[model samples]
Target: MNYIIKIIFLFSICTLVVAEEAIFHKNLKIKKDDTTVNVKGGFKIIREQFYKNFKKENNLDYNFLEVTKKNPRHGDTALELTVGTGCIGSKADCKRSNFESKKRVEVSGRKIGKKDDNVWMSMSLLIPEDFKWGGRLTIQQWHNDIEVYEPMFETDIKNFVGLTMKNGSRKGYFVLDKPNKNCSAGSGDGSTGANFCIKSYQEFKLLNWDELLSLKGKWIDIIHNIKFNSDPNKGYFKIWINGDLKVDHKGQTIWKTHGDVEKYFGKNRWDFKFGIYTTSKMAFKLYFDEIWIKRSCKGLKLKRLGYKCKNLLDQEGGVKPYSIKDISGNPELAGTL
Candidate 1:
């Protein structure tokens, strides 16, 4: 029978190359002018930087970023962000709404510390249950490139940490942006005081939409522990999701130069973007995996990656509060939730 059908078609091509080498990993594929990638101590990451409305003549060639292995929440590959629907934004000159054009795919973090340092980041977010809710979504952000202005109370300083998600009536909340002191003055040109601070921790809710669709397909382990000071009693900003301890928070969190701290000194720091930045004309498919940054948790070795770093960080004092019914323990808290 033709040598038993060539041994069952080469054993079905060696079981599809061992199930695609157990979920893709040909050097962590991510190319499209790959900017950066190299993790595990020596640190480096600034990969897949698309967005300027996915430039290249707005052609969307990279097709909004991908490197999927299906459901990877840890290893083998996972970074699939898609934001389709007019995609315009290079300042959206030919606007079409969605707040005049905004839709993004991100991955930024290449060191921009200083001012008390102490950074730390970790990721693994997956929200696929057919995600599509009204507008305003900004997965994560700690941005502050510079916008200090008080050259005469024309007011436009800055201080705005981020992490948004919205959909009021049909219910879907997850917002955070704490730190308040919206500067209306100070810094006639000395920097660090056009402070348009922020404050919106939306109490945390899960009122409906079937408890926000029971948080779609799962995998949500996030962690961020910053400490860049603007001195709200020595700045702080802690967060941890899946493993609990939601938003420890303290103050300021960062935003110093805008005028002349020696002409923006090291030029204002803070940078750590995440995928999916939306104004939402509806269309998004997010998933990301084991993205990490370290400064501790033994520099995030995480017990050699098997993880059990005791809910992450606490090398003897500070950043406590673990399981309290799983992250902000939902059950109806309103606005900015």
Candidate 2:
């Protein structure tokens, strides 16, 4: 406990993914203010201070975000995020409703790090019993990007890397991209220049649906370990659900969108935000709570939610692969993995 294992991020990045079909809702009670009815008023001072710290350090606009007691993961309060349909009559000014608005209750942190750095985050998610449980919903994700102009194709290449989810069976995933040269360009200085292209790394599922669904109607704990701004061969990412390892990937975790990519090597920092994000036009509710970030595995409260995340950081070094240490009813092989 000597190390400060977690830090709270009160992010305020307004991201309204437009042109994409918006969300819809069902029998939920709607307040006179047009918001879906739920718990109100009951805020945690500790959580509020964390939010305030984020505002003071980053100074991002969080007008669309909310922190209330509508629901919580552990304490008397939690963060409730609702993604509403963009059109209902013609009130295009629904805070973040179409005609150019925001999406989800987004909160961004300061930055990932100054390249080749490791960052850890922990939180719990509660998918309300009434949540529209269908289709692919990106409840949470890793994202950071800055566009760059590529002269080779005479077009711009948005160099980006991050994780995404889909098809709603309550799943989480991460996709990898192999950095490869796209094409060669003629250099005015008489040297051939090359552009980069990323080959998709098939599809990597990080969350176990069965284990997650088993805890339905309750808060599910999660921990994300990220190696920031590392190139394809040097980066890594890991995720632990409750107390099980779901993703233990060791490869590039970040890349520059477009630039002299090499000059800023290891200087690029990443960011993250979680809430309801999906292409399905249905009503849904996503709740979040007890989110904290840390620099290493120094002081994270793994057993905070009744279950302990054993074998933590199994991929950091020479840890063995995941296996059933012992089989049930087999006393002979008990204590063996």
Candidate 3:
């Protein structure tokens, strides 16, 4: 009888290991005439309660996608692209909406009046309050149309990063233009360098500029690191491109006066919004599959945000396991200690 009991216990342990290992997974499907992908979390939660209780105490890493099916010259078709979201809203008053709100948002694809043969799309996941500084954002793209944006608000904006691209003889990429004291970075004026722009090789080669003056272009797989060292009075900012030293700025100060720093950091305790954006014109298809954000030094740790598993075996009395809602608001057994 004891041997039989031990055999049963071993089988249960093997099943648990399989379940845990399955948590980290992904699925993607593409067709000649259509493109569809679904990202389902291994963990489920209550859709409504998850967002309501979402705070610094319950932070989790979120993912977004930006992909294209075909070259732009093929003409536009009524394509349907689905994105899973907890909430969505308009340009000014965006908020958490229901799953039915999917139709309201536009999918990145071939648009009218563009000379390029590619499509681009962008989505951003807002960082919850109580997030620490110095984290990494990872972007994986199948094609070349992917561009990730990391916006920072320091005493002064430094270490602006952009993407570089080339098409045959045309060449161009993206860059962050400096903003004027009176104007912000998003403004259309020349003062705001194309915070992120794509240049074609044909355009660059035509300039006939010096070799040193010419911009190099090609398909690139790159990662950018934005670092910030902050105190009460000031902050120092630095950016590393593709794991190499690119731009570094120092002696910068924030909240030089009063309320300056508060105004920026007050919103949900997030320093700034970091995400991706695409232009209406692109020559080739791009894909942004997965993105992971974590506190800079500690790596990616989700448990710090009040996510705890219940120790079912070690109950003080006949206590029941605690249930928490995931981002989708589905009820899930709390993690076991």
The C-alpha lDDT values of all candidates are: 0.46, 0.41, 0.23
Please identify model 3 stretches exceeding 4 Å from their true place: 1-234, 253-285, 297-337
- TM-scores, all candidates, are 0.27, 0.52, 0.26
Sort order, lDDT high to low: 1, 2, 3
- The sequence of per-residue lDDT tens digits that candidate 2 reaches over residues 1-337 is 3233322121212223221112111211122332222212211121244434544565544322344555566555455555455321111112221122222334444344444567776777776666545556556545432221111000000112112221110111111132212211111111322233222222334433554455557877767776754455666666666656656656556554444543542223454545554444555556677666667655455455554445675434322322212232342331121
**CA-only RMSD, every prediction:** 20.0, 17.8, 23.5
Alpha carbon deviation, residue 221, candidate 3 (Å): 5.4
Q: 189-246, model 1: which lDDT tens digit per residue?
A: 2222333322222222211245335767877666666776765577766665565554
For model 2 the TM-score comes to 0.52
Q: Is candidate 2 or candidate 3 better by TM-score?
A: 2
**Top-TM-score structure, candidate number:** 2
Q: What is the number of backbone collisions in each predicted candidate, taken in the order shown?
A: 4, 11, 32
Quantify how close model 1 is to the true structure by its C-alpha RMSD in Å: 20.0
**How much RMSD separates candidate 3 from the native structure?**
23.5
**Model 1 alpha-carbon miss at residue 125, Å:** 13
lDDT of 2 at 233: 62
Residue 316 accuracy (lDDT) in model 3:
30
Cα error, residue 230 of model 3, in Å, equals 6.0
Off by over 4 Å in 1: 1-60, 70-77, 80-121, 124-141, 144-223, 227-229, 236-252, 256-272, 275-288, 291-305, 311-337
- Which wins on lDDT, candidate 2 or candidate 3? 2
